[model samples]
Target chain A: MAIFYILLLFIITAAIIAVETKNLLSAVICVGAIGFGASLMFLFLRAPDIAITQIVVEVLGLIILIRVCISRELTFISGPREFFAVVVSVVIIFAIFLAGIKVLETLPAFGTPIFAEVPDAASQTYVEEGLRKTGAANLVASVILDFRAYDTLGEATVLFTAIIGATVILRKKTKKLLEEPDV
Target chain B: MKGMTIIVKIISGWVKVLIFLFGIYIILFGHLTPGGGFAGGVILASCYVLLMLAFGREFVEENLPLPLASKLDCVGALAFAVIAILGLVLGGSFFINFLYQKYLPGEALNLISAGTIPLSNLAIGLKVATSLFLVILVLSMFRPDMSGDKKE
Candidate 1:
């Protein structure tokens, strides 16, 4: 759709600005804009859950990034090596784009189910029997929480580990300070 | 960090409560709605972050102290584990919907009928909200050197 293209354009523009901006704060803001645009695209694609997650995660990430940026000098002018790296990345992106176009041509048209050629048994089962099995109105929630719960548990553990690591690493000085109060 | 202007503080004081309520609603209605534990938890964390931004770290800490946040984080994880362990005991499988068929009738689209799914969501929401708040709080506590020099 035209709206998708418009959102894509906005995303591309924001991403470029995020990458090219000298000021770290502006770059962070631009990155947030890109996230917003991408979440809108996700919404257009009818994945409301993904969109909500994406937007919320993006906001949280933006806040952390802004906090980090605030603790340091903002100007981040790219050096010659960084410019060269950018050029190399652009070339790689173009190559990938060309390859993707060729690959996409061989595939089904956009919005057409790729598994139409072969019956999507997995998704069909989830769609038809998911409610009966899980009793949740939201199929995605049922799938994640009930069906693929082990994966969710693993993700939760990962989050816990990450927080613990961060706390241990960042709180080292505070721990030392607390231990040696006389100093 | 010193907070923003008085106007921002006043507005955030009013807005934070609504944000927390909305987050709870999202978590509670997760099985029937788009948002689940993670999204709702992030929103809840954002409410706290907003309050911190508007009313300084000290004020925010006074309300939800670091120790309490840490305790909640542990409690959330423990709750989730206990649920999973219960499922294992009841259904012979980890994270099984054991309560769905036996105790609670499988009534479609009802809030209380989702069995352990809503319980899991609540646990995850609590864990995520507290952990995120802790991360932000700890990060904010650090007074990093702005001169690009390593701390001795």
Candidate 2:
């Protein structure tokens, strides 16, 4: 759709601004804008759950980024070698993008349920039986919490582990602060 | 970090309560709505972050305290584990809908009819909200400049 294409363009532009900006604060703000644009795209795709999650996660991530940026000096200078590296990376990324487009051309058009001559059996089943099996009106919630509960548990465990790791790593600084007197 | 201006503080004072209530609503209605534990939890954490920004670290510490948040984080995880374990004990499977047939007897789309789902959402919301707040609180404690750093 034209609207989707416009949203995609906005996201791309925001991403470019985020990457190209010299000011860390502006870059962070641009990244947040890109996230908002992408969440809008998710909404356009009929995924309100993902859109909500994306927006909230983006805001939290932006807060952390701003906190980090506030503590550190902002300027980042690139050497010739770094510029060369960027060029190489951009070329490699373009190559991959072209390959992806070729591959996509071989597949069915977007939003058409049939894929590779086979029906979308998994989604069809979830759509048909999700409400009856889970007794939750929100199919996305039922799918994540009921049918895919194990995956959700694993994700929760992963989050817990990340927090634990952060705590352990940061605990040392606090302990060192407590043990030492004022300099 | 120092607190923000007086206008910002006064506005955040009023807004934070509404944010907390909205987060609770999102968590409670997760089963029938778009939002779930993770989104609601992040919103709740944002409330704490807002308080920290508006009222300074000392004020937030006086109200919530880091130790209490860490304890709540552990409790949330433990509660989630207990819910899953209960399923295993009663239904013979991990994270099964054990309470569906027994307690939550109502028509679909009702708030009280989602079996263990609402309970799981509550546990997860608590865990996520507390853990995220703890992360931000700890990060805020670490000053980049040791010479200028002041421990509260």
Best by lDDT: 1
Pairs of residues at least 3 apart in sequence or in different chains that clash in candidate 1: none
Tell me how much of the true interface, by contacts, candidate 2 captures: 0.61
Please identify model 1 stretches exceeding 4 Å from their true place. Answer: A82-97, A115-117, A176-183, B144-152
Stretches of candidate 2 exceeding 4 Å from the true structure: A80-87, A114-120, A176-183, B144-152
Fnat, model 1, is: 0.65
Local accuracy of candidate 1 as per-residue lDDT tens digits, B8-73: 988888888899999999999999989999899999999999988888888988898777788899
Worst 10 residues of 2 chain B by lDDT: B143-152
Q: Could you tell me how far off, in angstroms, the CA of residue B104 lies in candidate 1 after the best superposition?
A: 0.6
> Residue-wise lDDT of candidate 2 within B71-147, one digit each (tens)?
89889888888988999999789888888856665679898877888888998899999989888887877754343
Q: Identify the candidate with maximal DockQ.
A: 1
TM-scores, each model vs. reference: 0.89, 0.90
Give model 1's docking category.
Answer: medium
User: What TM-score would chain B receive for each of the candidates shown?
Assistant: 0.92, 0.93
By summed lDDT, which 10 consecutive residues of candidate 1 chain B come out lowest? B143-152
